[model samples]
Target: MNVQRGSTTFLKVIIFLIGFAVLAVCIVLLPEAARRDAIERPGDYSLYPLLVCAYGICITFSVALYRVFKLLTYIEKKNAFSELSLQSLEVIKKCTFTVIFFIFLAIVYLRVHAQYTGDDAAGPISLGLMGILATSIIAAIVDVLQKPIKNVLNS
Candidate 1:
């Protein structure tokens, strides 16, 4: 279902867009500090690809989150689990898994960056990554626990 119509959804889309912009700036600007002969540095912008992957995962999760909010509204209106709502929930579960998996991968990428550059930047990166991991875990648990309850409610 389309999420661009409602005012609340518009706010969510704006938030997502701002997040993407910040990520884009980081991916573009951070690696320029590396000198060509810097042995500790990768000397290449390999981190950009990983950042792109993380951004993609984040966008997917953001979209899923938006859809969930929309589904909450739909559920309030219908007071029952329509097929579309269940499908949306299932999709959200999958998105949660995807987000978690990508966050793990991004952690690995960040580790590589830390090792290659000796930049000691991993602390903040790890914290942000952990936040993403926590978000994914919460989403997964909520989805799993709510699915059957929603089904029973519909029945």
Candidate 2:
């Protein structure tokens, strides 16, 4: 039990740091990059839609991260097998699904833009595809984890 608690504490700290880092990247790095680009080209805002999509993904990602952290807290509190943990897993799965939806929307938008602009949108499109794939996997894993919890709750 002591070892398990130690591991949970370590995971909690890592999760906290990951959340902080993502928040910093969204707030500081992304805006600074946009500012730099604006300085270079004052009126070109083609990337703004992608930035909005990124923000959408970030919001969902933050929610999923919080849910994971909450699950870890439940584990530490000796409530890992409770309904709250199951709910956390369900929320995490939904968050991943939301992220996949946003990525798919971005990919569709990129394809449409590329049709007219003749620009090389393959890079971002591929990234969006990868993002969708990753999120789908996360959702699937959450679903797998949910089965036993549902069984436990039912029986």
Candidate 3:
């Protein structure tokens, strides 16, 4: 099946821009929370891991945005079911892994940080991470499984 390059590219560009905007907001907002000292007890500096996870998540979104731009340009010339979309999907699959990894890292950071100060915000952050991790995993699985089915149905 032929996908309309103009429409698909526009759609992907919109999504990419939204993601980039969100990441930018997160980068600007996270520093306030991250600046708090986690030195409640000896060796209780879980803040570093939280900062690292935040940075990782931001970087992952940045890479995904770059990939989306590349995919748009590539799809403009090539067929929908061509090798281009497959490669783009591979990049998306890797990003999903990164999402899952960062979510898990965030969960760890939140859990450890909460132990020292009993911060109320940590619980909600951990819950959010769990939700994101689950969604990313499901999306990745669907993308991986749906491709073969789509190809077969089209053929």
TM-score each candidate.
0.60, 0.93, 0.67
Error of 3 at 147 (Å): 2.7
lDDT of 1 at 42: 59
* Runs with alpha carbons beyond 4 Å of true place in candidate 3: 1-6, 19-23, 31-46, 120-122, 149-155
Model 3 C-alpha lDDT per residue in residues 2-112, reported as the tens digit of each score: 567668767787977788686766767667565555434446555667778777877776777677677667666654455666666677678767877887867766766
- Summarize candidate 1's per-residue lDDT along 8-118 as a digit string, tens digits: 556656766866665665566444433332445555666565656656675776677666666666655654357667767777777777777777777777777789878
Cα-based RMSD of the predictions, in order? Answer: 6.1, 1.4, 4.8
Cα deviation of 86, candidate 2, in Å: 1.2
Local error of candidate 2 at residue 23 (angstroms): 0.6
**Which ten contiguous residues of candidate 3 have the minimum total lDDT?**
35-44
**What lDDT does candidate 2 reach at residue 57?**
85
- lDDT: which is higher, 1 or 3? 3
Number of the candidate with higher TM-score, 1 or 2: 2
lDDT of the structure predicted as candidate 2: 0.89
Q: What is the lDDT of residue 53 in candidate 2?
A: 81
